[model samples]
Target: MDGRPSFLIGGGQAADAIARIDWAATPLGPIGQWPQSLKTALSMMLLSSFPKAIAWGRELTTFHNDAFAPILGDKPQALGRPFSEVWVEVWPEIQPMVEKAFAGEATFIENFKLTIDRHGYPEEAYFTFCYSPIRAENGEVGGMMDTVMETTETVLAQRQLAVTNAELSHRMRNALAMVGAIATMSLRHATGLDEARRQLSQRLAALGRTQSFLSGEAAEDAHIYELIEQSFSAHPNLRQRIDVVGADFRLGSNQALALSLALNELITNSIKYGALSKPEGRIGIRWDCAGFRFVWREAGISGVEAPSREGFGSKVLMQFVPASFSGQARMRYESDGLIYELEAPAAAIDNT
Candidate 1:
C-alpha cells in the first residue's frame, strides 16, 4: 500500500482496517493495483453513517462500514472476505439479488425476510435495502454496493398489532351477542311489566359491574375471591351476613364473566327473598381446589320454593355459568333455602 491511499482516508474503523490490511495477501492482490472504481466505491461506502457494503472484483471481495458491524453480530471476521462466503447461511436466499446488482440492475426491497444464523442459532430477520451496481472506468459492471437497514422489530410489531386488532373485534362481537341474549331472557321470564323492568335494569347493571372488576391478561383474568367481592359490592349490608369459603385462584376472561354474573343473580335473589331477606338467614360459598367444586348454600329461611317458570337468572346459574367452564350445574329449592352446585375440571376455567 502507498502509505495511506487518498480513497482510504476519511471513514472511521473501516477505513483504518482497509488501509492497515496487507492487500497483497488477498484475492485483489494489492491496494495500489485496485481499480479507481473500487477505491471510489470503498471511500463513499466507508464514509456513510448508514450501514453499507461493497462486493468488488471477481472474488466479490467484501468491504463494509463501521455502522454495518452489528448486522454481522458474532459471525466470523468479514472484512476482506468474499461477500457470498461471509453470509453463506443466507446466501441461497440472497444470491439472486446479488446477481441482479452485478448484472447492472439496482434493486430496492422493503421488509425482506431472511432466516439467518449469526448468533449460533437460526432466527428470522427482515431488512429494507438497496443493492446497486458499481461501474468500472470501462463502464462495465465491476461490483455491487448494499445500503441496508434491519427492520425485524418493526415487522414483528406490525404483525402483533394486526393480531391484537382481530382479537378485539372477535371479543366485541361475542359481548354484543351475550348482551342480546341476556335482554331477551330477562324480558321473557318476567311475570309482570314491573318485574320485567326491574329485572332487565338489574341484569344489565350486573353485566356492567362485571366489566369493571376483572383484571389481568387481556383485561379478563381475575381471582374467584375478587369475583365474589365485586358481586357483593352492591349489597354491603348483606356482605357481612354472607360467609365466603374458597381458595383464591385465577380464572380466564370467560370464566370470570360467567361466575360474576351467576353470583350477581344469586345476590339479587337473596336480597329479594332468600337469606338476605331475613336477619337471621346466612349464606355460604365454597369452592374446593382438590376436586373443583363450587357450591352455594343458603340457610335460615323458610318456604323457599322453585320458581313457577324459569327466569334468566335461573338459566345463568343453572346453565350458562357452568357451561362456560365445560361443566354441569344443579339448582335445588328446599323448604329452608336455595342451593346451587357446579362441577368442572380446574383446567377448564384456567386456560386463557
Candidate 2:
C-alpha cells in the first residue's frame, strides 16, 4: 500500500470503501494503474443514488456503489468478486447481454425476469436496465457498466389487474345469458304482450337484486334465509304471510341466484291466485340438512286445482331452478292447497 492518501472525490459509503480498499492485492494491481475510463465510470457510479456496477478487464471483476449493495442481499462479500461468480444464479440469462456490451454494442431491457438467490432463498424478480461498453485509451473495449432498476412490484401488480378484469368479463357474460333465457321462457307462457312484459321485468329485477348481493365483499357464499328474504323485500305486505324456518345454510353465488329467482316466482303466483289471494292465507317454508330437503306448503285458498298446463312459474319451481343445483323437484295440488318439495346434495349448492 502507498503512503499517500487515496484520492476519492465522492460523498457516499461506497466512495469511502473504495478509498480504503487494498487495491494492490486485487487483479487490477493498484488504483494508480487503473485505466482512465474505469476511474471515470467508478467516480460517476459512487456519486449517483441509482444502482450501478462495473465489470472491468478480462476477469470481469465487480465494483458497485452503496445503493447497489442491498440488491446483493446476503452476499456482502460480492463487492470485490467477479461478476460471474457473484450473480451465478442469473448468469445464463444475462450472459448474452454482457457479451453484446463487450462487443461494443449497448443494450437495454425492460421487465426482464430472473431467478436470483439474493436472499439466500431463490425467488423470481424483474428488472429494467442498460448495459454500455467502456473503451480503453487505445480504443479497445475494456469493460461494461450497468445501471439497473428493480420492477418486480410493478410487473406483479399489472398481472393481478389483468386476471381480475378477465374474471369480471366472464361473470358479465354469464349474467347476460341468464337474462336472455329468463326473457324467452317468460314470453312463452304469457297470453298477452302486457303479461309477458310484466313477467320479464319482474324476473330481471329479481336477478339484479341477487347480482347486487353477490357483488359485495362477502360474495363467495350467502345464507339461504338472506336470499329468500331479499326476494320478498319488494313485497313487504306478503312477508307477514310467509313463514321460513330451517337451519341456515350457506349457498354459493350461482345457487343463490337460482334459488332467489325461484322464490320470487313462487311468491308472485301465490299473490295472483294461491294462498296469498285471501287475507288469512299463508305459506310455510321449511328445510333440513339431510339431502338438503326443502318444502313449501300453501294454505287457505278455495277452489284450488292443479293447472291443466304447466306455466313458466311452475317450470321454474319444478324443473329449471332445481336442475341448476343438480337436484330433483316435485309439485302437487291437493284439494286444500299446493305443495312443492326439492332435494339437493350439499356439494351441489357450494361448488363452483
Candidate 3:
C-alpha cells in the first residue's frame, strides 16, 4: 500500500488537491502522522455529496469536499487553512458557535443572516447550518464539522412577501374606513332609496377610479394629462367641450390618485347640475405647473348652486383629496357658473 489514507483517494477535484498539498508545512504536521480518527471522519465527509467541512485540532485547520466549493464562492483557496482564517470576515459573528461545537455542544441554526464579501463587494447573505463536535481517539472533543446550505434567496423572498402582505392589509383597512364613513353619511340624510343609491354610486365611482392606479397594475406615477384623460374618457360629448392646457409631467403616486378622484367628482357634478348639463355648457381645465395650481371652470350656464348639505362628495373635494396632496381646495357656487380651484406647494405637487 502507498500508506496514504484511503480518504485522500478518488475525491475528484478535492481529492486531487488534497494529494498535492504538503501537510508538513501546516500545523497538522505530515500526512503519515495524521490521527486515525481524523482520517476516518474525512473519508466519510469526502464520500458525501453534501456541502461539509472539518476544522480540526488546536489550529482548527479546514478540510472540505468538492461539494463545498459553491459555499466558498470566489473566496481564496481554503483547503488547508485555519477555519477562522477562511471566514475571517464573519469570524466575530461565528466565533461563539465555533467555540460551542469544540466545547462538545452541537449547534444548529436556520436562516442565519450575515454580511459577506464574496463577490468583491459586501452583501447580505443567509445560511442554514449545523456545527457538530467531532470526537478524538481519547473520547475528547477534538474538532468541529460544518454542514451548511445557502438560504439567501429564500430569506429575501419571504421578506418581500411579508412587505407585500402588510401593504395590502393597510390599504384594505383604509378602504373599509372610507366606505363605512360614506355609508353613515348616506343613511343619515338619504331622502329616498333612489337618492341614496345615486349618492353612493357617484362617490364609489370616484373611489374605484382611485384604486385603478393604486392596485399595482398601473405605474406608480402618472402624468397630469393621463389622469385628466382617463377621468373624462366615458363622457365623449362633454370631453369635446372641455379644453385642457398644461405642461404635462408625471405626478407622484399619492398626488396622482388624489387628483384622479377629485377630477371624477368634479366631472360628475358638472354633468348633473353645472355647465355640462346645458347645451351651451363649456368647461375649461388648466394647471399651473410652476405654481402647483389647478382650476376647473364652467361657463355658458346660470343659477348653479352648491348642495344644501355637505355630502361625501363635498368631504372628498374640501377635505380628503386636498389633505392627500397637502393642499387646499375652493368651490364657488355662483349664479354665473361653478368654479373650483386647488393649490399647494409646488414642491409638494409631483414628488416624483
Candidate 4:
C-alpha cells in the first residue's frame, strides 16, 4: 500500500457512510459484489430525497431518513419488525393496500384521514399517501415504496369559511325584509291618492338603490350614514328634524335594504304622527353591532300607538322582513315619539 492511504481514495469511510449499504443474501453471494455502477445506482436510489421504503416479500422492509423515521411513532420495536407487527392497529386496512402496491401497480389516496397511536398517543392525522411497486432489473416488482403529504390545515380552514358565510347570508335576508315592509307601509298612509302614488314611487326608488348596493352591483358599499341621508332625501320638510348618530359601517344587499326600509318608515311615521307633527319635534336614529347583534333604535315620536289595522307598510316590516332575513323587529309607542328596533346577526351584513 505505498505512501498512499490503505483505503481506496474514492471508497473512503466517509464515502461509504453516505451511500446506502445493503446486507441482503442474494443468489450471487452477498449483494455487495454486484457491479460498482449497479451498487452506486442502488445506493443513490435509496438515499434520494423522496420518502421511500422497500417492503421485501410479505413482512420486512427498510426506508430512508426523509421517509421512515418521521412516521414511525414511538415504537422502539419498529425498525426490522414485521410490517404487521409495526402497524398492528392499521394492519387490517394496510394489508389490502400493500398487496395491491406489490402486484406491479401504483395506487394513490387523496385527502385520506388517519388516526393512530403513532407516538404512543392517539392523534388524528390527514395525509395523501401513495404506494408504488419497486421494480427489479427485469422490470418485475420486487418490493413496494410509500410517499405522503399532509392537508389538515387547508381542509379545516375551508370548513370554517363555509360555516361563516352561511350565517351571513341568513342575516342579510332578514334585514331586506324589514326595509321592504317599512317602505310599503309608509306609502299606504299618504294624505291623498296622488300623495300615496308619489310616496310609493319614491320608496321604490330608495329600495332599488338599497338592493343595488347589497348585490355588489353598486361600485361602493352602502354606508349606514349614506343610506340614512338617502332615505331622508325624499322628505326635505322632515330632513332638518332628524339626526343620525353612529360610526359609518357597510351593509350587504339584504342588510342595506332592511335598514333603508326601516328608516323610511321611522321617518315617515315621525312626519305623520311623531316629531314631524310638531314643528319643534326632533327624531334621533342610532345603531351599532356588538356580540354579533345588530341593534337599531329610533326616538322622538310623540303620543304614538299601534294602528288598529295592519297597513301595507306594517305587513312588509313585520312579516316580510323577519322571514326574509331571519331577524326580528319591534315598534314601541312613546309619549315623545316612536321607538323602533331591529336585531339580527352580523352574517346578514356580509353579502359575499
> What's the TM for model 1?
0.88
Off by over 4 Å in 2: 1-13, 16-20, 29-33, 47-50, 65-70, 73-77, 219-226, 232-250, 273-290, 297-308, 333-338
Candidate 1 per-residue lDDT, tens place, 1-352, comes to 5479888777888888888889899889888998999988888998899999998877889999999999989988788899999989899988999999999999999999999889999999999999999999999999999999999999999999998788668767867888899889977888888988888888888887787565332375787887788888888888888888977888877788888889988888887889778998899999987667899998998988777777789889888988897888988987778889989986776745
Best by TM-score: 1
Task: Give one digit per residue, the lDDT tens place, for model 4 in 1-352.
Answer: 3232222224333224324233343232334443343343335444555444445544444333334456665765343445666667777877788888878778899777767677878777666778777766666666666676666677677788898678566645754664465455656566677877777776677676566555554333477777777777777777776676667777655556666776665666666766677777777777665522434343554466666766666655666666545677776666666666666666655545
Q: Write the per-residue lDDT of candidate 3 for residues 182-220, one digit (tens) a residue.
A: 777766667889988888887677677666755754445
TM-score of 2: 0.80
Residue 312 of model 3, lDDT score: 62
- Structural similarity to truth (TM-score) of each candidate: 0.88, 0.80, 0.84, 0.51
Superposition error at 163 for model 3 (Å): 3.0
Q: Which of candidates 3 and 4 is the stronger one according to TM-score?
A: 3
Off by over 4 Å in 3: 1-12, 29-33, 218-223, 233-242, 249-254, 278-282, 299-310, 333-337, 350-352
Score candidate 3 by TM-score against the native.
0.84
Comparing candidate 1 with candidate 3, which one achieves the higher lDDT? 1
Better of 1 and 2 by lDDT: 1
Q: What is the clash tally of candidate 4?
A: 22
Superior candidate under lDDT, 2 versus 4: 2
